[model samples]
Target: MTEPDDAVPLRRRTAHALDLMAFSLADVRDGLGPFLSIYLLVTHHWDQASIGFVMALGGIAGVIVQTPVGALVDKTTAKRALVIAGAVGVAVAALAMPLLPGFYTIAFLQAVTGIAGSIFSPALAAITLGIVGPRLFSRRVGRNESFRHAGTAWAAVVAGGLAYYFGPVVVFWLLAVMAALSVVATLRVPGDAIDDDVARGMDKATSGQHRGPSGFGVLLHNRRLMIFAVVVFAFHLANAAMLPLVGQKLALHNKEVGTALMSACIVAAQVVMVPVAYLVGAKTDSWGRKPIFLVGFAVLTVRAFLYPLSDNSYWLVGVQLLDGVGAGIFGALFPLVVQDVTHGTGRFNVSLGAITSAWGVGASLSNFVAGGIVVAAGYSVAFMSLGAIAALGFALYLIAMPETATGTDSGPGVFALPHRRQVQRDAVVGGELVEDLDGKV
Candidate 1:
């Protein structure tokens, strides 16, 4: 009765499938991303204010659905199906954008895309956890992010080149292709490889207890998780608006070359993210999550201030390069931290959803506030304001957030679960189930 997850060959194949899935879903998850702003601004002649409102619509919708979607991932074993459905939803909503093009229609579609896109984060994390188990999760997450960034970099290059020749409309077709590939990748991951119990943070020790997921109150009472959520919210609040603002500024300066310039900005950051993600993944276990995460917040703070210092495209794009360090760390560490905090709660995905929803609130407001500021004052003021928020988040994280890595003095000792490695060792000795500290197997 060897589990599929324990089979080395199947696990290797599953890991490869996860890599392909991450790469393909990279483009599908965000829908049109900043391209939506560029398209609306340059093609449809929409003002920044209206474009921001439309963009915010999606984030707002995602905030509303993320928690519920996370709970759904926890409850269902159909993880692959959820990924497929989400990919289809994002692809269809984005591809339809060119045809509808109207304000309300685009807003409605963006909302749909947001709701669909929310499924990927929790589902993918759950699958990764279920397959690799907790001991290897940090490196696995790093590998996943690396592939995701590479996928984004590739998409930016292709989209930039095509849009340069064929106009922004080509991005829609590109999403369609990526979405199809994502579905293929999702199908390739053997569903049996996922351990339903492990996927939601249940371990063999507690499996026979038949205890259900801890109530949401457990998450609400976690002081550290709440603090982490606030920090992340601030990060997104400052981080989200900067890039789109740069894209808009570039568009304003040179409308004909806006898409290409935006692509350059994205490609630069994503290329940096690929390696940064791998580094964070490799070092997170040994170097710990806090110090690495602090670097991200610090880098973001610096990047924001630097953006307003220059209007030159190269300067702007170079400033964008710092995004790789900041966003790369956040991407790699976010899940690991949440997993650390909610280790035995059977609420990992749901808690992740809750925090991400908070992040969504910050991001949703970012576009609106930055847009209004740009309209009332200018891009420089908007960039500086976002930079200030990033600085505050950095200060808060440096002073208050605790280290969440296991075996650390400040780890989440409240959950009362055995160390992940100990649990694994206990499960495999002599091919017999050994009792854990609680005397349960």
Candidate 2:
């Protein structure tokens, strides 16, 4: 086990505080997002098909920035400042929505929101690495993701209630206020809690100079990484198809029935994650990431196919249970895949950004593609289609990927290059890796 050395205590306390801050912003953002489709329709009179299409288009358009955003974040000294400003921008853009002229303007604004969100995730991932290292990163991701998922669950109640009570305009105002507060809170926390001397050291050891192909091009170079990205995208596409349409099918039995069912299902799945994270934390590197991910894909595909067969809401909870198992695997392993590829590159944050942005792209495609299908065919077709995608994920992982978790790589890492081509280098941390880095290799 790696000892605390000089940085552990400082990082531990700071990580705890940042966890809370992340939970706060994530919570409100989740709340705003759940009701956004409904809000656009009810308040703005967008048709269901049109609303879904706009949401997908907005996500892709906005994330266009993500393709190159990682390079900028990796090379910049102003990461924290940029993050703080971005948080504030989220609030400002959200708040300004009520003042925007029309539906087209709202769609345009949706794209902008995606840009802000894209900046936040990878930057946050890098900061987490700096503070926690990969030692406890799973737990951190679990805690943050749970809050985010939970926020989405309850955000519906908040946004819908606010929209009904005060109007849709009130919803934007409330979300804006929460996001702005996140900015203030983030500023109060010391940036170096996660970025102290270790980052300075990391800068020396790896390509902190910010040289790389475009984010998309980087994806082209790594077959294993590309496969992982596709798996994640497949998972999200399955989700995009399920979450929106499943609710509608359930609601045909009763009004807003789908919302309650989906929320209940997601929350129950989320509740298992933190404990799973902690349990998986000690062994993630040794037990390997691929088998777990493959198993998850298989189980989730079964769950997807079975969901439509059960009409009872209580029975539906069982489907979510299976999904929870898959989610537990996904939440733990996906980051490991990204970190593995970018682990020694001094490009941890940017790599994470690129991978996550790929995830977002999956979400956009799934949402739009499924929405179009639902318009033409129906919900039965969508769920069945998700099952098919899950199968694809399972097959791809089985064929193309290998376990790259630190302790599992068998090459002696003897001929590794930090970037595209192998190059001369000494110790991984420039002279020597920290004890933890040494332990991994």
TM-score of each: 0.90, 0.79
Candidate 2 residue pairs in backbone clash: 31-155
Candidate 1 versus the native: TM-score?
Answer: 0.90
List pairs with backbone clashes in candidate 1: none
Candidate 1 regions exceeding 4 Å error are: 1-8, 208-218, 408-441
Question: Poorest 10 consecutive residues of model 2 by lDDT?
Answer: 411-420
lDDT of 1 by residue, 151-266 (tens): 99999999999999999999999998999999999998877657666788766466546544433454577888889989989999999989899999898898988999999999
lDDT by candidate, in order shown: 0.83, 0.60
| Residue 67 CA displacement from its true place in model 2, Å | 2.6
Best by lDDT: 1
lDDT score, candidate 1: 0.83
